[model samples]
Target: MRGLLILAVAVIPAVAQNPVVHLTNATHPASREFQVGDRFEILITGAANQSISVRTTMRGRTDWGPIIGWTNTSGRWSTSGQFEKGDFGDWSEVWTVGGKVANPALHFSVGAPCLKGGQGFAASTGVNLVISCETADGRQTFGTASDSEPFRTPDGRVVRGRVRSNMTADQYHAEILQYLITSRASDVRSGRHGDEAGDLIMKMIGPNALNEDETRNVLSIIRAAFERPEPIPQTARDPSRTLLLLRNLADSADRESVKQQIVETVAYVLAR
Candidate 1:
């Protein structure tokens, strides 16, 4: 089995209103785990009339400190941030907003553990973050209502958790696709069968002569997935299925079609 990081998530209120503030991976939803060092984006939408205030605090389950995103005054804005998990555990990102916010979106990155100072995050699995929103004044004065929602940090918990029967079909699909694209060569050579699948899948995807920037920007995302720790549980899904897909992908008769499918599927999996 491949190693995975686990993080703790903050509990969300059951009867909270609909969230006006939202957070997402720069390329995918929060259900997916991002490699350490990878960057994620933040977006804020909605209509804020008066002076608004927003504060987001994130803490990992382990003792590694917290990743915080905040705004003292609010308006309309779009920005990006990244997280660094010193040690592995469940990490959570909490967002609190006061004032008028129409529909704010947040985009950010997840750094890779192998990155500089990533040893802390790599020591274990990962951390978790939860997102929530509310009126700073606890009233409708901000032009928005109090709303809260829980989001699983893109850490491997979702992927591995699927085996224990917690993930949806879409979540599982995203996990598998992420594994295929990001598993690295070192991990493959580390006597791991899953990494072997990733190695084979990358070859099957085969950049196919893409230009410099195009290849780097496009393939980089896929490759980054391979570099992160495996989030899949041994019992969650059949490894054979993944290997079979990779092998079938190499078959010339259906190569182009499979390639297109992979591209489309990956794109959909990472879309905002």
Candidate 2:
């Protein structure tokens, strides 16, 4: 009864593995910082053949707490758009690629979204540029990279950069005051005093004069004024108005020295 028995064996084929893709390099500003009107490039590299999507975000506190760049407390600006494609806010851009490619380079320029306005006076340690990439189908992530660099407005750059380790407190104060005066003069000559008060607030709160706590408090006042839904009044924007405010604060014995410096700075600017 050893009948003829047949044995059948089933074989399964091995599934192909997906190629490893990742960001090899990403280029940015040489200084790792951004200023309005500045142009820079970001280059990302990886293996080719797969479609990928790239997204960039500005990572940091989103509150109106003192930052070096713009703020939207007044709602005059839109913060919910793509920055690469020209929108505002911390979330920057989302770009896609469909064809085979080994490298992708992105170009950008700092604009109004990086300017406009701000609240509070906390010195921005800086913001981070967070980048992420993923499969077009969103199934697999390529990887992520971040640049913990600060984004500064033109004014911010000027004020912060002017601080020299070799400078005495008085020297620092005088130089910054002179800068404010020159800036105000330029505005006066150009007949555009736009945001002069705002500019003053920025310079006065520089690292030279106030302690961190004082700077933050003063900035809070400035922030409250701008948080109004209505546009800031021109009178409020007046440099003289800011001077008056500074003078009033100078009357406080504790803030006398710093406030006097700011008052002198504003006076010099107005005199110019």
Candidate 3:
């Protein structure tokens, strides 16, 4: 995966002037190549009781965006950001506290050399950076439509891009069902019986993808997977933590009925 994680340090000193912030420990990958989808974390510090905010902007672009507030901990704060090849370009990050701008913005680039065949990143063109789908011949599709397209139905249909209009109810349910089952199976096979499967399910279902019946069925499947007595090779499975996954999903449910059903099911399992 081509990506960069920059760790920055922001210092608010006793002197009133010249508040400086810069990346201290920049760990370059052995390849020194960074691409979209890679994340960077910055460690920031502010004056006691000072409020902090961070924002990033593409270089030479008029708009500065994704402004976010920092969570302070004893005059120190740490925040992270990710690169999405969609908006591939030179980028800069600025920090502010108590309405004072921190001098010198952090800068980086997201584009080709990171991708196969040296294709430049384009926002309109979806880019897949996390998972590599290289062919057995070591051939990679770069700059092609298939290069960045991530999710696809088993039938070779792309799942994104006005996808709802194209999918039938049965198709949607089938896709989600396959996703949930596959996620659980993968986690189990990898010796993980924790929240990984649960997290994937929540991400896939999102807001209102599944109806009540679908939700119940999905939860039951997950419950059965968790209940399986597969020995985790690396670490012993924690049943309480496993149960917490269901509880967390229940808490995130928007519908009262769905929430209640998940909660009750979790409780019943706990009783068992």
Best candidate, lDDT: 3
Best by TM-score: 3
For model 3, the local distance difference test gives: 0.44
* lDDT by residue (tens digit), candidate 1, 49-72: 222233222231111112222322
lDDT of residue 25 for candidate 1: 57
Give the per-residue Cα lDDT of candidate 3 at 100: 46
Clashing pairs in 3: 2-35, 86-123, 128-148
The models' CA-based lDDT, in order, is 0.33, 0.31, 0.44
Expressed as tens digits, the lDDT of each residue in 1-272 for candidate 3 is 12333323345433433334544322343433345445445555545445554444332221222224442434455544454444344445556554445656666555432434543333333323322334333433333233223322111122343245677654454445544443444222322343334444544433322334445665766565456545432333444544655665564355798888787767655543
- What are the clash counts of all predictions, listed in order? 62, 1, 3
- Residues 22-45 of candidate 2 have per-residue lDDT tens digits of 221112334543332233332222
**Ranking under lDDT, best-scoring first?**
3, 1, 2
Number of clashing residue pairs, candidate 2: 1
